[model samples]
Target: MSKYDLIIRNGNIVTAETIIQGDIAIKDGKIAETSAGQSLKAIAKSEINADGLHIFPGLIDTHVHFNEPGRTEWEGLETGSRSLAGGGVTTFIDMPLNSTPPAINKKNLALKKAAAEKNSLVHARFWGGLVPENINDLKDLFEDGVLGFKAFMSPSGITDFNHVDDVTIFKGMNEIARLGSLLAVHAESTVICDQLAQEKIAEGKTSARDFVESRPIISEIEAVRRIISYAEATGCKLHIVHASSRKVVEVINEAKLRGVDVTVETCPHYLSLTIKDLEQKGGVAKCCPPLREENEVEGLWNAVANGEIDVIASDHSPAPPHMKEIQDGDYFKAWGGISGAQSTLNVMLTEGYVKRALPLEKIVQLTATNPAKLFGLFPNKGTISVGSDADLAIVNLNESFELKREDLFYRHQHSPYVGKTFNGKIITTLINGELVFKNGDFKKRAQETV
Candidate 1:
């Protein structure tokens, strides 16, 4: 019998702190040893000669909409997780909307999990919704092992999953704080968005530019300000999700400076695409809190470099083809989403690490470590340390690929980044010692533990 089940040798292992030339040994589906500057000499049943590749901890996307149970046609667990595995993601936190019945309480959470258990190719966790109807169920939901609660300050688009008002949020924040759970907000002001959208609709100005103008920067910043105040008062750990504006990040950073228990995440679409892409691509690129201008994109990049942004998630909300209104080319009538889950890592690598020279450590922090720590999955899921789940991705930094529609695993097969070129490639992905994906092909079913 072999001393270990698998050994990955002669690769550069990256962690949140540093990167080192190392070999990793896996035993019983856990990382047994990470030997730095030396190869593991232990006998193994299988060995991969990973020389010259960058071995990163498998990415944990903190936000995604798989839309299971009620909205699988939009994006189901199986196809969604396969896409994630192909992108080198081993774990993801599913949001509480889009899915029918929404994950508002223990029963709905169980229903979502049942669907996930049947189709998920990766480890998955759920987030409970903080809608007005579910304010009384927050405690039960948290105790049910939801990583956190998700709230939309503006309309969530799905009729069943309505957004929370100020009163509902104030009460929900207190409940979540009492339960020691985090609250992640889609922080766009409802009043501002509704008013502007109505005005634009009445004026017959429903173009991409009109949609962008409807949700001004102040809408996001104003909601961030309100959420920060509530978090401060209630002592809840607050996370602002998918912020697209530099001003929103500025508000979050200033709050952190003042001892507010807050963090912020930006999505790959926001960092990679600008209003130009939105104008050109039309509905496929349209998303809530629409993509900002080129200058704001530059500002967001600067914030990432300066450590003002805590995490970078996919926020991979996808809709059916008709929902995007690709035929009509009507931005206002289209469902707002971006199918970029499989492209998040590559976008960051190309735009941040390669072009802008962001350190590998920072990329790891944004993609894996910060999200893991925030959601209570750290040390187990986010690091390449001993005893952690053997979840990793072997990346060939020298290789490049241009994304295409056929390459996407999304059910809709539409993405804003379809034609973009990326520098780094996920050559292989391992989840819990199983080679789930290699060389652009799936090898096995994802080990769905948790």
Candidate 2:
């Protein structure tokens, strides 16, 4: 009989604590033990020689739009999860918009879970939508195991997922606080965006750059300040999703100083690419809380390094060719999203680690540990300790690869990072003791759980 189910040997195991040269032992889909500098005497059913590789906890991207049950053609669970796994993400928290019937109620939540179970290649946790009608449904959804709740202060791109006003936000925050669940917000004020957009339209400014200019950094900063004040008043644990401006970061930091329970996340796109990229890439580079100037990008990196930003997620919202319309390349009419689920790690590694000289431990904390801890999925999903789920990513830090849209695992063959080079590579991904990806191929069908 095999002494263990699997053993990953001769790898540099990197964790939030420290890096160690060790062999990881797995049994029944859990980490059994980790032995440093000693050959395992026990026989094992399988072994992977991970020589010269850096093993780290698999990434947990807490923000992604899988567009299932209604918008499958844009990006479905199967393609989205595959993209995540390909990027070395073992788990993700799916946002509750863009789908036909967003996960607002129990019925919608059930539909979303069913679709994910059938198609997802990774473990997925759902975020219940916060809307006027769903106020009564929040408890049930939280009881049903949703990671948290997500709301937009501005009009969500989809009409079905309506925006929440200050009244709804206050009520929802109170309820979320009662349940001890986090409330994640898309923090652009609708009234401000509407006024600015209308003014820009009247001025005959209808281009990608115009769109960006209309949604100024002040919009994000003001909305963030409002949310922080509300959170302080209501005592709600708040998470600002995809914060894109320096002012927002400052506000969040100040709120924390005053004893508010708030956290913030910024996407890889915000840290790596600036608004200037939008000029050349047009619609493909567009995103909500649109990318900012180079100086703002620098400030965001400083925040990440200085421990102001809590997490780094991919905000992986993908759209079909018709929505993006790369051929016509009209920014004003194109959908606002960037597809980079499969390049999150490499992009961050290239920019955050190599260029900015951020410590590898900080990268792990932001990408894996912090998200898992913030969303209440920690100890199980984020760490590489004994008795945890054996989810790991073996990365080759010295490897270099240029991102090509054609090379992405997403259904849509479009990416803003296309043609950009990356310094690191995810060589293998393991989920629950099973090698899901290795040598640029999936070893088994991904398993999705509720």
Candidate 3:
């Protein structure tokens, strides 16, 4: 006889393989058994009836900026974790740059971890920054339990976190490869983007449209090519983040076939929004490696559907309202980020599943399984099998609702998704067998803030 802490009955469990209708039993914060028959007649002290809902393995978001320590004013770790939980994410990996001290060394990483310990509501890992000054510290940071390292091939928006040149990237990649960790890059050529931005601003053509043009697909394509070559030469595992172009996906696929250890990630915005949305919504729609044309959007969706793209993350970088809402419409001065932490899964449901018939298994791979395996958290965090943590997101795929500012859990409720409608609403979320969130809870949090 097995002891049970919680039992979820009759849910269609979505996994990387397929969806199965079964009952799951949890004990000691881990899954104990799943039954499709009368294997276990005993009931747990707690139970959830999910007869018509979909139970999915918890999502792992590998790219996010909580901006703790130094930039808590922008978005604190507490609010950020709440946002992740509300979005049905059970685990998240925070980027290094937005916080003060940047997590480039042991002491800074310790500071960031300490803050997360006190504030984070779910599992939180971190990515160390790979900069010119910290090549010597890579060992210490990796030993400190950083999942991997992140480098910007172009100017990172933070003042102190400078972008890496080829020499710096090469050196960092070699060291990282030797340590057997991955290096993720924000791959947009600084030379192309910076030069064009200067020209655009100089000519006073600084609208969001001009910003998009200044950072054309060529900038991203050139940088992706350069970084992939570096990774191939150094044998470093490379990951390209927020890839927004059809051409970039084609090159990454070629690199993969040529046996370069590379993986590509495209954000939900790339699959859903286009330059037209940016033109209509203004700065809130602004982000680096700016949104592509409609055809490019379809291409990214195609890549996802074809399994060419490996992961889909929110890249949930947020800023204050004043930073995003500029009075003069000087788009260049506005923050180049989208408050997207809570709406990524929603977008995928609306655009990827309800609209395009993206297989549920494929969605699970992009959102959960691939990330867990990529970062060495698989089997423990990514699946719903025995001996795994009982992290689950149960959703009602039948319901549809329009998003609003008051439904957000961010410190600032100003996402560009406020007016968008989405299907597949999260019904309940569990982390380590404990109920953490339910539908309509975000509205309560949002009201309390007011």
Candidate 4:
């Protein structure tokens, strides 16, 4: 009889606390045992010799736009999950807006859930939408097992998924608090940004820099402060998504000090690429709360280093190339999203570990452990612990490669990161003991969580 179902040997196992030289054994889809220095002597059905590699708990990106159902051409669950698998991410929280019908009601949530269960190669949870008309639908979606609700404080580009105003957001937050659920906000001032953008375009200042300047730090700060007060009043667990600057982190941290149950997430683009990159990359680098100055980027990194930021997600909102026209197109009209699901780990490895000397434990905390805790999937999905799901990503930390479009697993196959070199190549990724991705190939089966 086999003592274990699988064994991975001779790797540096990274967890939230520290990195250890060890071997891990898996059986019946869970981590059964771990050894200090050598492979387990017991017999196993399969084995992976992960010598000379670093094994991390599979990354959990808590924010991504895998626009399924209606926006498949933009980014479907199948190709989206493939991109995630290629990057060694085992789980994600799909945003509510981009999918057809936005997952705001039980029917739409079920539609997206069924689509995910059918096509996703990795595990998925969803964020239900909070808009003016859908306040009554929160309980139904909550009962259907949505992890949280996402509300955009500014205009969500999709007309169907209208952004919430102060009254709606406050009401939604109160209802969510009553249900013991969470609410994530896209913090941007609608009125201020719209006015600024319109003024810029009216004056023919429609360049990338103009677009960047249109969304000011004051807009973000104003929105965040308003939402924090709402959460304070409602006692709702709150998450601020894609926090782009040091001042934003300061505001979030100050709220935390005031006993608010809030956390901050910053994307890879915010940490790695800056206005300089945006200027060079043109429309491809465009995103909401546009890239900041180099000083701002450094300040955000300092926030991550000082343990002020909670999670790091991709915010992988992608569009077809036609909608994302390059330099010749109007930057003001181009799609404002970055297709970054596949490069998050590489970005952190290069920017955090190799360049800035930030600890691997810190990276693990920001990218995996903290996100899992925030979304309530910690022990089962985030850490490589005994009795937890055996989701692992084996990486060659010494390797570096210049990202090519061919290297992208996204349906669009274009990113602000194209041609940029990064370290920590993901060699293999396993989801719930299944070998889903290996050396850029997939096993091609949907992940079903029991």
Question: Which pairs in model 3 have colliding backbones?
Answer: none
Off by over 4 Å in 3: 37-39, 442-450
Q: Model 2, range 212-327, lDDT digits (tens) per residue?
A: 88888889888999988899889999999999976798989898999999999999999888878988877788898888899999999989888999999999999987787644
Q: What is the lDDT of residue 267 in candidate 1?
A: 93
What is the lDDT for 245 in model 4?
Answer: 94
| Tens-digit lDDT string for candidate 1 (103-145) | 9988999998888887888888989999999888888888888
lDDT ranking from best to worst?
4, 1, 3, 2
Q: Which one wins by lDDT: 1 or 4?
A: 4
After superposing candidate 1, which stretches have Cα over 4 Å from the reference? 326-329, 446-449
For every model shown, what is its TM-score relative to the native structure? 0.98, 0.97, 0.97, 0.98
Which of 2 and 4 is ahead in lDDT?
4
Relative to the unseen true structure, what is the Cα RMSD of model 1?
A: 1.1
Estimate, for each residue in 222-299, the C-alpha lDDT of model 3 and write its tens digit.
999999999989999999999998789999999999999999898988888988888888778899989889999998
Off by over 4 Å in 4: 326-329
Clashing pairs in 1: none
Going through the candidates in the order shown, the clash numbers are: 0, 0, 0, 0
lDDT of each candidate versus the true structure: 0.90, 0.87, 0.89, 0.91
Q: State the lDDT of candidate 4 residue by residue for 1-450, as single tens digits.
A: 988889998899999898888899999889999988665788789889888899999999989998888999999999999999999899999999798778889999888988988899998888899999999999998998889999999998998899998999999999999999999999999999999999998998887788888999989999999999999999999999999999999999999999999999999999988888877888789899899998998999999999999999999999999888854546888889999999999999999999999998898899899988888897898899999998889999999999999999989889999999998899999987889999989997545742
